[model samples]
Target: KVDQSVVLAGVKMKNPVVVASGTFGFGREYGQFYNLNELGGICCKGLTLHRREGNPSPRIAETPMGILNSVGLQNPGVDAFIAEELPELRTHDLAIIANISGNTPEEYGIMCEKLSAAGVDMIEVNISCPNVKAGGLAYGTKPELAAEVTRMAKAHSTVPVMVKLSPNVTDITEIARAVADAGADALSLINTLRGMRIDVNTHRPILKMNTGGLSGPAVLPVAVRMVWEVANAVDLPILGMGGVAKGADAAQLMLAGASAVAVGTACFADPYAPVKVRDELAALAEMQGISKVSDFTGAVKPW
Candidate 1:
């Protein structure tokens, strides 16, 4: 069997197929369906400082070959996560990654402080989310703001800290390097691209939110290119996602320089996508004569 173990940010994972944030709720919901230990890690849903009711009705809109979501960083707040969700989540016995968001830098810091004490394996700051319309996209698109936020989070976090980046920026590498310089342990890309869909009958926005973040197979190629660029620019470990739907799709992201692959939209269709990806990666590694999947990281064949 080809070796798939990866030691990322001091977290030794069995493989590199982690469930994306927002896609997988705090383990309890999906745990009933699959064995959580089978996967590498869990990037739980976007958590805020306090419990959020979330967006109005119709938070998710289906489009041709894609999905648009405005989840609005809804959560039971950090305390509830630790007091309630974390206790049950710790039962999974796998590396746990918390994806966090807030309305401002101070809020992000507070969340980091609370989650740090909760003994999470790592924290992924969800700076790319656009649905909240506050401190979400503001921190992600600008290089300076992204770095500042990364710096503050790293300051407050005791464990590994990763900044989830947005693809809507003109230069992703610039922001990647900034985050790395600000003491980020790793980076993840690309969060959902900004997209909007209109209603044919009413001619208004389909969702009451008006706009949402787009993700799925449609954004995979762009995510690959961004991963390739960021990996070359920064030496920090990179987690890649956008439209990973299959084993080969996961492999492609790894070859593009992502140290690991995240399953997002793919999970929507097949709750078993992560399992399938994990198996496919192992099989492909053997077929390619690669003893370890990390050996192919950033090996995007330059044609």
Candidate 2:
């Protein structure tokens, strides 16, 4: 039998296939389709200090090979998640990760502290959120800002902190190094790339925000490249994600140095995406005669 376990920042996961945050809404909606415990882990929807109504309608627009979303992190406040959602999530045996977004560094620290005290397995700091304080430039776009947020978050949380990097930056590896140096225990990348679409006849943008994050099979290459670069740049473990839709895609990411893989857009297309990726990874590992999944980490051979 193959061992698909993955140890991310000292947390042992049953497998290396975690459902990406924002894609899986606390696992309640998908739980009706299948058992949530079968996957490696679940990163719940992005949480904020207060509940948000999210952006206006038409927040989602379908692209050629992906979808653009300006959902704007609509979620019940963190307090509600702890009181109502976390309990239902605890019923599952998989690792529970809380993904938090903030408009300021202080909010990030506060959320981290709350999640730590709440007994969450890990806290993923979403630095990619457009900084409301900085005129909308995302914190993850700048290495210094990313590092500062990571440090603030790490100082407040006792649980392991993972910094989720945005792909909209000039050099993602630079931001990755910054977070790693700021004491981030682990990393997850890359967030959706910024994109836009215009209505041909209306001569207007498709999304209400005029622009949104693009996620799907189209971003796979970019994700793989960034993961490979960051894997070589930082000592922290990485939860590679972007456009994972199948087992083969997950395997490609693993070979490129992803300690684990997260499914996002694929889940939107199919609820069973995460479980299927895990199952496919197991079969591939067995075929390769590998017993442990971690063996694939940084296993890629250079040309």
Candidate 3:
């Protein structure tokens, strides 16, 4: 039998199919479709120190091959999540990863401390949020700022800290190296690429936010390339995510060097995407005469 289990940065996952942040939303709605325990891990919706109202309406726009979102990190706040969501999530057998975004290093540290104490399996730091103290520059766009945030989160959290890297950078590998050196336990890569859609009839932008982060099958190649680059540049385990829709997609990311894969936009199309990917990955592994799915990690052969 093919063993699907994988250990990502010291956090044990039943399988390698994790639901990406923003898409899973604490696994409540999707929980109705299937058993949450059937998957590997769940990276809950992005959380802030305080609850946010998010952006204006028409925040989501459909592109040719993907969707763009400008949700603005709307969440129930960290305190509320710990009080209202953690208890129920703890009952699940899979890993519960808290995805957090903060306006400052201190905010990230504070949330990390609170989430860790609240018993989350790990903290997925979303440095894509604008750093208020840095004059609204995203931490993930700057290597030093990204490292600073990673250090602060690692310092305050008791659980493993996995910094989620943004794809809106010139050199993702440099940012990956920075976080890795700053004590990040693991890394998740290729957070949505910035994009926009326009309506010629109205002569205006399609989304209320004008531009949003693009995610879906359109970004799969970029995700794979970045995952491979980061994996080769740094020695940290990676939770590669972007446009994973099926088992072959997951296998592609794993082969590109992701220790595991996360399904994001695919969930909007199929709530059972994660489970389906997991089963398909196992089947593919068995067919390839591979006994363990983990063997797919970084197994790509380049010419």
Candidate 4:
């Protein structure tokens, strides 16, 4: 059998297919569908300082080739996650990556410190989250703000930090370089691009939040491009994600320069996407005469 195991930022994973945060729901919900241990890692739903009720009705809107959502980082708070979720999640025998978001740098540090103490395999800092201190501007949209959050998380977390980048930025490479320079051990790219939907009849915005993050097949090309750009710009390992719905899509991201690929909206459509992706990736690697899946990373040729 081909070796699918990979070492990302010092953490050994069984494979390079991770379930994106927000889609997996602490691993328990999806565990009912399949064996959670069959995949590389699970990035738990985005966590916050306190419980969030999320936005009002119609938080999600369907687009032609994608969906838009403004879930507002809804979660049961970090304390509860650590108290109740972590113990059960540990039973899965897979790398558990905590994805944390904050309104300020201090909040990010606090969450990272707690997750690190809890012994998570890694911490994925969601810098795409809005910084309340900066008037609701996403931290990842600015290179300086992204670097600041990366510094804070790296300082407080004992585990390796992977700064998740926002595709809404003018120059993603600049942000990637900033975060890498700020001591981020890894990176995850192309968080949902900003988008919206409107009601032609009522002449109003369809979603309550009006603006939402877009994800699905439509963003795959953008994700690959951004992953390639960031990969070329930084030496950090990348957890590339955008619109990965199949094993071929995962392979495309890996070839573009992702050490691993995270399944986001695909899970909503196919609960077994993580396992299927893992299997498909292995099949593709063998078909390509590759024994080690890591060999596919950044294998894209310009010629």
Report per-prediction Cα RMSD to one decimal: 1.1, 1.5, 1.7, 1.6
Model 3 lDDT tens row, 1-303? 999999998999989999999898988887776799998999999898999888888888998799988888888999999999889889999999999988789999999999999999999998764212231237888899889999999999999999999788888999999999999999998888888899999999998878888899999999999999999999999999989998999999999999999999999888988889999999999999999999999999989
**Residue 157 local lDDT, model 2:** 96
Candidate 1 segments whose C-alpha is farther than 4 A from its true place: none
Write the residue-wise lDDT of candidate 2 on 167-241 in tens digits. Answer: 888888889988888899999988888899999999999988888889999999999999999999989899999
Model 2 local distance difference test score? 0.88
Local accuracy of candidate 4 as per-residue lDDT tens digits, 194-238: 888899999989988788889999999999999999999889999
- Cα lDDT, model 2, residue 156: 98
Error of 4 at 132 (Å): 7.9
TM-scores, in order shown? 0.97, 0.97, 0.97, 0.96
* Global fold similarity of model 4 (TM-score): 0.96
lDDT of each: 0.89, 0.88, 0.89, 0.88
Backbone clash numbers for all candidates listed = 1, 0, 0, 0
Q: How would the candidate models be sorted by lDDT, starting from the highest?
A: 3, 1, 2, 4
- TM-score, cand. 2: 0.97
